[model samples]
Target: MPSVHIRYDNLKPAVKQVLFGRLRLESTRWASFKSWYQFSAFYCAPGEAGAHEKGGVEHEGGRFRRKHLVPPPQVDSLAELNERLAAIDVAEDARHIHGRPTSIGFDFEAERDRLRPLPDDDYDCGIDLTPTVARNSRITVRQGYYSVPAKFIGQKVRVKLRANELWVFDGRQVVARHPRLTRRYTYHDFLDHYLEILLVKPGAFAGASALAQARAEGGFTKVHEAFWAAAKQKAGDREGTRMLIEVLLLHRQLPAEALVKAMETCLRIGSVSTDLVAIEARKAMEGTDDDDAELLTGDGPADDAGGESAGQEAAGARVISLHARRLPPDPRTTLPDMSKYDRLLNLGTARETSQNQKGQGA
Candidate 1:
């Protein structure tokens, strides 16, 4: 946590500005570098420096590569590779150094006690960029397209690109987030983002990238396909697709696994109605039985004739009809008469006429 010595080559703009004490370095303009300035002091080695200038660091790099990465371990993911490297580091910590009396682990423990504690706040290492959402509700970052909410189409948004994920912000509020895609020209889409638009154009939902990704990820289960086919058979293609869209929209309110399970149960029963699907999906989400749910939803069938009459007699409930109430007349208040106002108007006219006649006689 003391001062760090780094090579001058490939220096960040903030570090360069702080070291050189100038707004422009060589021909590059300095950008906001508040993050680098807040932490430990930085010392840059001379340009084109020899290995002897940073001998310890250079030697350590070679030792690490030879000791741990020589064979180049094969791993499925970056997480797995990091796990292997961490294990290697822990194992190496027990080995004694060339001149040291104790192991590297002991030395590190002794030095760590004397070193300064880390700062309270972790540094923000993400790169921030502003990208406008395309009309198709996607934003391109580093040649990889990511979907935002369709409502944000044609609007500029802030993107924070981290090592493993990307956070999207519309102003201060985060609107969308996705795992970072390393492949160029690849897209990460969420089916929920396209649901609103797909409802209006059901045909486009079949060929949508979001749906395709969902299928690839197994999020679109076999039950969904079965239900869609059944719906299409019952209704036409467009109406069936719309029905499917309604089912998909349930994902907004229900857990995905629950919705899929409900769809599976519906498929087993050969029920393809959207209403049935919604009822079953809600039951699944609430972890309730079908009969109980039917009763609660008021969709359960009535009992047999004798059972119904018996139940009605046992309940003894009466239905009351509601009628509009009429207001009573008030005897204390009466309408104003117009005759007094008319006499006042005639008196004013007679005064005006007498004044005009007297002026003519004079």
Candidate 2:
């Protein structure tokens, strides 16, 4: 018998009793992958090592790459490279292979209805790990530290590490989510995650990495800093920071824009009271649509509908207007006379109605 060759050099250990491919031995991991997709594996005949390469199967990929990707593309990120590759693939679908009457796309379109439907449930193509939270309320994932809620400190959390995001779960409940760090040993933090700990150790709030990250990320606005400065000045650092943390905790229940607006409201009156901020936060939220919150976000006036600046109109969404395809004025039908209503309302005749309608023949 010839030795088995696998694409993966690091195949995980398989089921002890289960075996396949004429004593080639399948790993459990490989078996599970195949079973999930309902895929069947066929290998070379016994004592025929070169049999699998009979169709030039392995060389097709190399040939395709050389043909399509001969000149390496310059891209800023993997996302950009993938986008470029997708465009290239779409372009190649129109290409006519040698001896084929129809283009690749035409053949594919003809057979598309015959292809098997994809699995209903999506496969999670992400790495999973369980990491214990450190004293700093952080977990090390692929040499990158990510902050979790302080309540989970010293406890193990399950993490799903995806291509661009990391999701931290305490049991089935998601506790934290952060963008995956591109650099090794780098860390990402959220200010809300550290609020509970900061409340107890008020002195730490000023120098906390989470606080710095929040400020840089626009989550901590100038309004928050202004409120904090006022609170500290009025009540001193220890007491003031504790109060700020209390207000920060409200973020779990309230929207960020509400908190920002509430902070601004309180700061206007020189108050650092957490109770007042809560009152204002609720007031800011009363009768408010979720989308309206974007306008009030404290960083600045954000772009509104049609990319217009927020300051264009405070009550813009309420302004109603009607528009439609312009039907040319029928020379036979006279325009409605609004002069009577306009005169009664004392707004003056609304642009003199067409006196020349009859003269402009139908």
CA lDDT, every model vs. true structure: 0.74, 0.72
* Per-residue lDDT over 24-119 for candidate 1, one digit per residue giving the tens place of the 0 to 100 score: 243222232233333332344445543355557757778999988989887644557778988988998999868889998988888886555656
Distance from true location, Cα of 172 in model 1, Å: 3.6
Q: Candidate 2: deviation at residue 114, Å?
A: 2.7
Each candidate's TM vs. the true structure? 0.64, 0.59
- In model 1, which regions exceed 4 Å deviation? 2-14, 17-39, 42-44, 47-50, 53-55, 63-106, 290-362
* lDDT tens per residue, model 2, 10-63: 223433332454345776556776565665554444335544534554476687
